[model samples]
Target: MGSLIPCLDLNLIPDYSIAVTPKSEPKLEPLDEELYFSTPNPISNSDPNPDPNSDVIQEFSPVSDITGEESDVFSQYYRISQLFQSVFARKLPQHSDLTVVDPNSLAIVPQPEETGVSAAVLNYKKHSRSAEMIRVSTLAVEDARYFRNLVRTTRMLYDSLRIFSSLEDESGRTIGKRMRGDLRAASLMKSRGLWLNRDKRIIGSIPGIYVGDVFFFRMELCVIGLHGQPQAGIDYVSASQSSNGEPIATSIVVSGGYEDDEDAGDEIIYTGQGGQDRQLARQCVHQKLEGGNLALERSKYYGIEIRVIRGFKYERSITSKIYVYDGLYRIVDCWFDVGKSGFGVYKYRLVRMADQPEMGSAVLKFAGNLRTKPLAARPSGYLSLDISKGRETLPVLLFNDIDSDQEPLLFEYLPKPVFPPYAFQQLGNNFGCDCVSGCSSGCFCAQRNGGEFPYDRNGILLMGKPLILECGSFCCCPPTCQNRVTQKGVKHRLEVFRSRETGWGVRSLDLIPAGSFICEYTGVVLAREQVALFTMNGDSLVYPSRFPKKWVEWGDLSQVFSEFMRPAYPSIPPLNFAVDVSTMRNVACYFSHSSSPNVMVQYVLYDHLNILYPHLMLFAMENIPPLRELSLDYGVADDWGGKLAICN
Candidate 1:
């Protein structure tokens, strides 16, 4: 490749001015030994002395200031940022067992005999070409599934790099310059021909992405074909795609970058690209009807719809801004005008298309208001402010908006499962890792999880296994160990709301990222023999065997891992216990059943080392928008008559 250019930072020379170049097919060549083993550190722009020829881009602050209350609201996110930094600084474990690849051949690498984390990494590289071929030939019907897999795989790869960066001996010094994870990950995918929607351009919606989908980085938008330009606010198709041989606008990002940009819920006053002195935050020259400006004019004349993505300052993120796909919009009106800086600028009015989902930014704003002032935002439906009665860190709101003020059948809110006496007696000696700081690569707990940390630095599960062994009470590691994820109780603000169709259900007041731990299925544990008795007596009993085998599909790893290289987890004996949440339950009890569920049940063993009695933890299966109902597959027919049994 060439010297890497920082694309997402708008403070750099505008990336919009760079023409979109078609990616050439990758030719097989001998892998550069230095490139594979030692990635050069990106040139630093923070040097006191200047390199006149170096197009160095410094990191820019997206937001000027954050209020105290806002800081408090996003305190959890700040902790996550710190956690990521610590993980990055730690030395990754050496993996001598990894299979070495021949630099001269492009043939797929053979599966390694050792089935560990390092093996998985090699498998990912080996199968990249195969996965790219499948993605390129993907039919429209498979677009949604393919897109989801691509996004998940990209993030997983990026996270893996951050935690497992190449190191130089014991000093914890990384081999190369530390770069932004998103950029590095996206670049890797692009070089390997893994990016989708490359050969053709779509004028309207991308098939797999939804209206309210949330993206954390600008490169995500580029890789997913939502917005082709990494930093450019405008995305358009050139003259080749048009009948009149003129470019047409396809999408634009309204991120408050231009002073003239105005965002209304269903409408946006979008400022066309260019004619700005970004350093001075003002227009310096007249905006010409060329490039994006001309494209927008052509789109309006041709009655073409444009995609509108909105960006907001996200206090809970390291990047500081989140982009939401707000659906398609038409360029209804366009005009040249004298701007705030008294310079000519192009302005366009865009009206959102009809029958789309609620504006994503509106939902975020509403959730924020609800968090700050619950009484004012939702004045009516709340039944009890704190259903846990101060037991939980965050309040669990009980609401009834459908028909009656009737609360759920009275029950104790149990945060953790209560095991029967015999369940504990069955446990062999409990063990824990002895890392005083935090559980890392060499920790015993990580070893138990196939010689790699089960989670990434940010506490997101890296992959789904038959069982995840977390640090227990016996560990010398601190309570904040990345391994101890599910042990932490519900992190999101949840609500038990009455649904007109599904009875009582749960929804989140925050955006839940994919692989994020939601909560545990807490209840009174019963012996396996007692399950049938409880079911016969009309008690709500959850059978561990009844949960779907969706773990194999969690990270979409089938694309990379060959059949043999995939983790062949030891068969976990059938669970000897069942949880009865009918009388004593928590928020997990209200999760409704869905054929295509957003939440997945992960079997985790942390409090104890017993495999037969692993804890049932719920995690978000994909990026869930605020106020969206949380659901899981119950692994039963929809007509199943059991009432409470279906919800858990």
Candidate 2:
């Protein structure tokens, strides 16, 4: 979920501290290079009498610093870092036999049958200087992933210990609650909840979250439910088990709340910051389901994403925005709560996955951090489209017809689309950028496409130079390299809507700023002759008998106008192929035509270099309000096609 998830309100200060497990904040010792490397605490081992040389590093010197590029035994250093982290954890895996598989070498290293704790520690400490090495190492992103996981795990593992220790010593409930309050007087960054509290935009009644929405409401790590309320279902805490002996995710209810108080006698009337009564409604939901949204017969939501506000042992801190994006879950069951309050309330119990990466505040200090940022996205929505009667769950779309139920004909007759170039080509022995400063100066591809990096920092398309282009697979750069902007997909909140005038149209569920990637109109690639033949035959099949044959004539004329754009964008491949979303489609096919459209199609040549046709991508040309229809110019669609009566 990208820009779509509504930001929390700002004005209303939420008291999330229901019962803070009291634990005193640890004092941060001054940074001392020598002290950090020396054994602050002896390594714990099963040996009742430890070896005198256990703490000694005979082979390596005490590590003073860890700059990723400087170390020769970087691999060995990384492995030991992981080992130290495991030892730091409360629960350790019992290793009687370990199978270290090296697939590339087709080799397997097996541990001895009598393997025990002493051997494990001995094996781990083989890299005599790893502890100090890790402490000093910058911990590049490649090596930082495990370290981040370790920090989060340790915090949670020791939380209970702190609580117990605090109870034994302090005799108070709110004992050491100031762990995050650093006391350095560092500015407490405004939280997402604070921002949302200030937002007064009330859609029907509630500000951002609603039922049927997927991954919309981001729950805080320790928070199990609405700030302090107990009416709805609480976010299940996976750390603990439930009545069913599973992770506890149950009792989340969002009820109408319907159109008006007259209908929703069960409406819970709440006061806003301005002291006006507000009602959270089910207005956004339709009893009549859409063909794409995958909702159950009774339940609305697909599932939700869980985020925990991870607290660290101290050092740097991560903002609430950088959440561990636990993947989406499925709604197991939902039923009418039938509360006495007369609200048409419903409670949905979600089934959390037994295994998934925990998104916590534990991020690498040096390697940036692991966070769930708004996806520079390609898919229109966060969750997958549901399987409906006319559509299969396997993504299907056909652009020519609105109810395009056919699979791409090309797939049946031809091989599936391959990566760019398809076959190897010799390096032209020409100048190519290091991708560091390459985009700024002399990369021929970048100069022709305007700046090397097409998108700005927030993944926004750089203005003035609007023709979207990116370095293809042939480019000697990693995928994460900056020059690939359009490759990153639309991060906006969008939905396909059915209208009276237009069968289906695309719109942003969230407000979209100009220069955002609205969507990419993708489909089967066809040759010019193939598309000509397709329309010639498709005209009769698609146009209903009830409509006059003049529609067919108009379709032909529209084809001509659409082709006039061909010569202008040589990159758009010859009118050789047009994207067909009718059979397998996304939100792009639903976009309607407008003379002054909010979005426009731009040609991009990346991903597939062999295909002469540049991918005609969609981007927002102007600001689009929430729930406003998005349209394309449709290439002078005075007649048909652009303003097709049946847009898939």
Candidate 3:
């Protein structure tokens, strides 16, 4: 089996008692202000006057020769062009299973004659495939990889469209004010037959979607077939589709939208939909035994398992609330009750099914408790309270529960990478943007990152890029700048705990959102030549190249954004250095290898301008549940013999 890092040897430095630090720090030369403020050049060093018909020029060329209202349209077009240029620059390998029935059926908006702008710039659209055009997927329900790919791709496309719509709004266009970004994206996907599990509805748990899985929007639930209803609280199988020729409840979302609904970890009192004046937040009329209400009664009689999703108000998120799939539940009982509005309402008592993973909401509450009082929660298995010893912003606990081993191999805990003198010498010149408050669109640093900020307002990575350029030390932007994400050490509370299957592994004490920065791989940076010498001397080195390039699988926007619009990423020279973390490393070193990982490694540049040796940062690939072991694909064979070798 192939190894993750070809020459990775974990048994480096037999004596772990010694603390190794960089002998000398490289002195960086002062930046020349004249050179720093100079107008930045385009990413590509191609001809200044390229052919007008060239796809690159045509798609990315600045819009000129426009006046008045047309300027807003053109500016919006340019913003979208830049967004595509920054985010979807890399062309990923297409999945063989993903087949469009009608590849030529493009969804192009009618261009207004006044603007005379390209239809592609007016509005990004999906390949408008009819419902009949969708072929039943041959992939099995248990095919986790395919399911992940489908969900991720759908999400990426949705986000890309949402960002495009936001760009239009930013450019002073008020086109989609009533329709939300998610709804708009969902509409596009639905029109193009890009959604999954739409042809069938399952009575039990949806395959590939596990209990504790989270979603930010109702449309996402519909796209993944977790629940078909977008706004309705209850989803049901119609009488025609049911086995007994009777409507049965399939799933329900408990969002506390109704005053009568009650949620207790394992049990939920779900209120039937309808008969409520949503505008007045009250029930004006009595609910009739029909639709979802009748389905619940039938489910109770048939003993059918109904999927329950719990929703919570999430102020930090743009969606305002988060939904967690709480697993299967059976409607044990149903009855009519007078709600607070003094109107009759139907209530169904749903009990969680047996022998399933812990409820996602319960786990979240437990995680919150653990975070508030760590000592009271665990009480045992803790080797050290704060592993960083006041180095990191959050505590990194060292835990041992499965074994009698007192502690992991002794090594100095470092939060960031320590570069040798030679590594600094490789960095020739450092330049920064002159933005006063923060670096936004059109800033030199933003231009270096392809004319847009790499991260969103919440500091979430907008999309995976070949190389992400962040504000450097010379930048005038404050530390709180949105561009500086990975630099902000460890956003989530993580702990290194002993695992029975994978030795010492890391798990988050807090829930990690998808695309949020996790932590950086901190250690002594070794140059290309020095890396070989250290390897020959039996020192373990981590090769950034060994990490899987699954960023391509994030999503496919071919139908949404035209192929020609996505130009090749600016050529970033291959990174040559390896981080020697065998002796002196952070929690990232203890992360176990998995064929299906929840985290991804992203190369980023911040402290230095050298793109050749960017810092290796890890970001959550999906919404990770609390206490779940964090894993990453090590770019090795699944059956690799050295899998256990990574366990330290």
Which one wins on lDDT? 3
Residue 598 alpha-carbon offset, candidate 3, angstroms = 1.8
Supply candidate 1's per-residue lDDT for 389: 88
Q: Better model by lDDT, 2 or 3?
A: 3
TM-score of each: 0.74, 0.32, 0.76
Of candidate 1, the 10-residue stretch with the lowest lDDT total is 24-33
Candidate 2, 1-648: lDDT as tens digits: 112233222122334443322211111111211211222222322122222112221111111222233132322212222222222121122222333243222222335563334332222232211100000223444334343333222222222122222222222211112111111001010111111211221111121221211111122211211211111112222211111112222122222222221211112221000111123322222111111011121122313332212112322212211212222334455554333334333333444445543222111221121111222322233232321222321232222223443322322211122223432354453434455434532455555443234454455443322234576565666666556766655555444544556666665544454556666665565554555787875641121111111111110111112221111212332333454544554556567775445565656666544335555566665434444567775554342214554353
**Residue-wise lDDT of candidate 3 within 39-89, one digit each (tens)?**
232222222221111111111112222122443232323545443432222
- TM-score of candidate 3 relative to the true fold: 0.76
Q: Which scores greater on lDDT, model 1 or model 2? A: 1
lDDT tens string, model 1, 495-613?
A: 88887777888888888877789998888888867887777867567777888876766544233222213344534787667787767888888888765567889898877666778
- Which residue pairs in candidate 3 have backbone atoms (N, alpha carbon, C) closer than 3 angstroms, thus clashing? none
Give me the runs in candidate 3 sitting further than 4 Å from their true place: 1-142, 173-178, 239-245, 315-318, 338-341, 426-430, 537-539, 554-556, 564-567, 639-644
| Cα lDDT for residue 558, candidate 3 | 66
lDDT of each: 0.62, 0.32, 0.63
Query: Would you give me the overall lDDT of model 2?
Result: 0.32
